[model samples]
Target: MLSIGELSKRTGVKIPTIRYYEQMGLIDAPERSSGNQRRYSRQGFERLSFIRHGRELGLTIEDIRELVTLSCHPEKPCGDAHHIAARHLASVQARIAKLKRLEKELKRISILSDSGHVGECNVIRSLSDHSHCETEH
Candidate 1:
């Protein structure tokens, strides 16, 4: 058995995060010693490692919980995991599309401002005019 600090060190997870995981029911509660100090088994380390990897992959807390549940049922197909990844990919794609539009708008503004003063700047005029942006649509 290991102390909470030792478990944190072993898994590269912060102590408070581990406690939060416990509160969230991501990791099972550890056994308490006579002094009420948390004592963790090797399985705790493995569980924490899984949680850390899921977090690094940008999985939401709820998604991570579902993935952990899926991990326990290894006999089942991984379609659910694939679905989660696809959803995340779709979100990233949407953000990229929005960013590309913003980039185009900024480029248009910058090109129009080349050696131009603010008083007669097309960039400022565009900024003041919401009708000029495709994004406002």
Candidate 2:
């Protein structure tokens, strides 16, 4: 068995985070001693390690919860995890596309403003013109 501090050291997660995981019911709270100090079993140690690994992979709390539940039933299909990963990938690709569009717009403005006076600055002109918005009129 290990205390919370020891668990933190073993898992590389902060003490407060372990408490937070307990509060979220993602991990079970360990038994307490006469001093109200937690003592964890090997299972708890492994669970903490799993949670830290999930967090490192950028899993959301809900995703982690789902992963944990799925892990509990080892024989069950994990297609949902794959679905979640696909959604995250799509979101990342969409952001990359938007950033590329913004880069093009910035380059266009740069070309339009080169050596222009402040009053004639195309950068300012483009920003002030709502008609230039890629998202709207």
Give the 10-residue window scoring lowest on summed lDDT in candidate 2: 108-117
The clash count for each model shown is 0, 0
TM-score of 2: 0.67
Which is the leading candidate under lDDT?
1
lDDT of 2 by residue, 1-137 (tens): 89999999999999999999999999988999899999999999999898898788667888889888988998988898798778777877888999998998888888863676889998888778777677864
- Angstrom error of the Cα, residue 97, model 1: value is 4.2
lDDT of 1 by residue, 51-117 (tens): 9988887778999999899989999899999999899889878889989988988887778637868
For all candidates in order, the CA lDDT equals 0.89, 0.87
* Model 1 regions lying over 4 Å from their true place: 97-132
In model 1, pairs of residues that clash are none
RMSD of each: 3.7, 4.2
